[model samples]
Target: MANLYDLLAGGFPIDRDKPAFLLGDGSAVSYGELESGAAQVAGHLIARGVEPGDRVALQAEKSVEGVMTYLGVLKAGAVFLPLNAAYTPAEVDYFLGDAEPRLFLTDPAAFVAEARTAEPLAAAVPRADGDLASLIYTSGTTGRSKGAMLSHGNLAANAVALHEIWGFTPGDVLLHALPIFHVHGLFVALHCAFLSGAPMVWLPKFDDAQVLAGLARSTVMMGVPTFYTRLLANPGFSGEMAAHMRLFISGSAPLLESTFAEFEQRTGMRILERYGMSEAVIITSNPLTGERIPGSVGYPLPGVELRIGGGEATGVIEIRGPSVFSAYWRMPEKTAEEFTADGFFITGDVGRQDADGRVWISGRAKDLIISGGYNVYPKEIELVLDEMAGVTESAVVGVPHPDFGEGVVAVVIGAGDEAALIAACRAQLAPYKSPKRIVFVDDLPRNAMGKVQKNLLRERFGSLFMA
Candidate 1:
């Protein structure tokens, strides 16, 4: 398929009457309904002057309409930008200012009303393989969010690779509870279903009781580490309940060895952990029909090239593949700097390959933290903490947590009350960005160049939450 939309919507050939999305309200959206709905929404977008290559930003609640809107963006040949629903108005403003989307969709009623009067497009807008498909914003070390430009080929290639590797079939039912803003949910989970024509048990959000109850109906599930931890704590979730399930995939953050082991012990099935980022939908995944090793993300997907940059046992991971994004939106120089001369995208993650070629991420080259499937930049938190009263300077690092893959910890060199500092952070940042623990220190260790040694801080407080 030349367009990513074709790759997704092409499932119509398999079985148009097949149920595509089984919603929480006991409504089943068939493939034919999804196609018609997406086409109508696309017609509305075209009526509003959305053209190919134009950005269409949506910051709305997760619902059947939300998914249809995403498909509509693609069907209209506009680049879809799904913003986090939890972002404050200020954050939304920043994204709108940067991306400058032609249409900003918010209310679901607007979409539904437009669809009612709209007509299906005679044909999907013509798009080239290299044309941009979506723009996913990821925070940089400098505190500014950079939009990753994912091309049509990038998404299609990854979807095809995952659909085959994960053994997805039309008979499978995916229990999808992940938010649609990120790649794990939007590109990975949704793409697999679209490619294989699989049905999805769609829940608005992850609820322990709801998920446990859905297990009997679902054959597969993809989630972050937190989902597994919460399910393990609930008595309703048991090995018997998951006995018929085909697979359990985890990504968007590292899965702790403890969670992996406990899940296997509780469910009698190992959780398959994978590695991916916004720049690339999925690069490595544990095998679907083989031995899954704990704490390793397993081998690279077919056609993906991965190598260590520094040549050490552990170093920055570089990747080159069709799935890798083309560039950063409107930042040519920054994009050029991120890729190597040989064309490998610098992943910024420090990892190593075992003797069997399984990739293991040790740490991040940049102090980017993934907490509860959300990316938390240390510089963002430090900037907030440094502005607080009685604070000389602050250093933030992510340490291992039993629940969140990594928990944010702020180490301060001045006399600030922990509760007050945390409250200040909670006011300025999102709940996920707020530091979980505060450690008051006399001084922060610095190197010869006067840079704060975050590695030293990580070493000092790695077990803060675990203890």
Candidate 2:
């Protein structure tokens, strides 16, 4: 049986009495309890007519029961599809309609309670390596969100690689504060802990005080750049709090170089930043025991093959790996279009690979700006804007221009003289590369994962150069 859960089950502590989750209230969920809870939930799914290969959708808040439900779905030989809890009714409607799951869980706690009455399933259902395990929807920055079909082999491969590369041991305790809806929290973070049979310190979401308190007991923490930034802002967080921690892994968004430097100054430890997407859970990661360079996502995993698509200094990223998803669920045309005939998936992320195979992402291919027939990469411009006086951070976008086909526009997060900012860019870049206009705001719009939504910025300022 190639069931992913079986692999996780095999990794559980030989003594099942060990804790699976260490709670803030001094309570703990034992590995034994987790196993039985999953059995009951699997039995409930079977009783509810959910068959092997059937889709089960979940859009609910983070909870212990939610994790149980996920494990149970796998045990029942069903495909698990997780939707963002923060999504609106209409947004949820689209996902549910598209996935067409046999069961949709709105309240995980209720389901857990109902499942307890059911008989526990004796064992996990058998599955092949290629059987679909989950459907993770993309961020939908430039188009409709596509459901990436990840298989048992895909999840297992990535989990095993991460568990080994990140060095998760039985004694490690993970401080897990991210939401379970996304890949960073659910697949990458949770999978590692489960694969190592290590316990996690669970929180409903990222809270400053809770995270600070949790740091005292955690051995490892995997979170987005925003988590680190918020911690830096809090006065209570200090190097001593994280002194005992072994690793801090960041992903899901770019870690600003300033944040990286500041964190090292405060904690005397460099963060391990990785690169990944929904299509492939995680492709490249900085070394756990080697050089963790700032702004670089580091090397590809052991079995993964990566290359720049256009053979240029900077181009779209393409990869072939076991961890890569099989296809987009029910979207044959879109699926075929995303992958090359040679079997590499075109990641649509513009980046470059160094001689040593280290990766540096510039921006999305779709986010590329064209002004006066010259190529303008937003990341290149954003880096320049970010260093200017009075600018905390910046998002560069291309808007309609009366003269140039498209005009460069900078949506900044702090106050600055527009002329001086534009002048600064012109001094460092070509005239066409400089922003035609600069707009200051309190903050840039970000998604649930802390990624700046460049599409929204383009829409908001699309009419900037029209007049």
Candidate 3:
């Protein structure tokens, strides 16, 4: 595969004057205009001395400016590190120090005066086959954040695969509202859109009202489960939105079964939930026409290999594909542990593939709650809780127990009769699988990635289970 920019160049020759992006603000930019604007930005970065392989960090929201900044960094041959727009200044400083970026790009309104005084670096044409084009930081549930090194090849291959698998065409209008710093929005959304010459509708942040408006003209909409839940609650949601959509994809976090059921009932369209991460843009997705299972994330994408690693250690989902990141930046040991000898990326997720080829994610390998010597996946408990009346969300963790070694404890968000809810659990779940202790909270703690931080729950309530 050639450089990502080279792929853009081919698209450029086809019909450069065609519209490429349609902003939420009612403005549209043509591919010719975008290419020209990016070229100017690339020239500016070169004049400021940004060299190839050096990191250029972007701390901005989803806007035309943010898109330009990303393309500029890539065109200049520097690796782009797009930070979450919600990140604090201290968080920005951490990435700046870790990645050792040559330049920090920010929205003019958001720019801090200090960045202006930093020294500039030289820019040069990049080697398309080089090791690093982007350094994406994972949520670091295990510990501190580690940068996943994505090469030009890794990104290019993934984008092409998605374009083929999803049947994306140049005329497809993709509605994007997720944070661009993550793979769901960056690779699966933007990169795929760009490679296919698909037009994009951009929203700076997720707002149910804004999303509903964009869906008026969009052919596809992609988001996490939380986004869907919020949209379902909106009074503006009508069956018409589903009629205009060709594909509706979900990822970054699991789609709760209750949320899926509610969405389909209201809009008359079953969402297509897929599985992906920062390491590999996407591993699997449900078929376009076949059964779109409620909780299953579906089969592997074209050119992607997946399987459950069985024997002694079962249920660990492993992947081998062109889209997989080459390694974790500056962490050889950690990268070595994440891959198998044959080059499959060992995903931390615990899942199983059914005979029909549908994939069901049970839980995270690290989040497994071992109570009374039996392994209990938290997802099972959460699923049960989500189905119960009035329960909005739930988190299950292992609490200490002197008798059983560990006990199942559930932290939930709900109202009304607590005793009645427990009775409902008794009717459905096995006694051992039921929560030994239940705590009601306003909201569960979630990281920027929208994953529940069960570690925080374990730390705060672990002592309660002690004898």
lDDT of 1: 0.86
> For model 1, which pairs clash?
none
Best of the two (1, 3) by TM-score: 3
How much does each candidate deviate from the true structure in C-alpha RMSD? 10.6, 1.0, 3.4
- Name the runs in model 2 displaced over 4 angstroms: none
436-464 in candidate 2: lDDT tens per residue?
99999898888889999989998999998
Worst 10 residues of 3 by lDDT: 108-117
Top-TM-score candidate index: 2
| Model 1 per-residue lDDT tens digits across residues 395-445 | 889999999999999999889679888988999999999999899999877
Prediction 3 global C-alpha lDDT: 0.80
Off by over 4 Å in 1: 139-142, 368-467
Error of 3 at 102 (Å): 1.3
Count of clashes, each model: 0, 0, 6
Error of 2 at 389 (Å): 2.6
Lowest lDDT sum, 10 consecutive residues, model 2, at 383-392
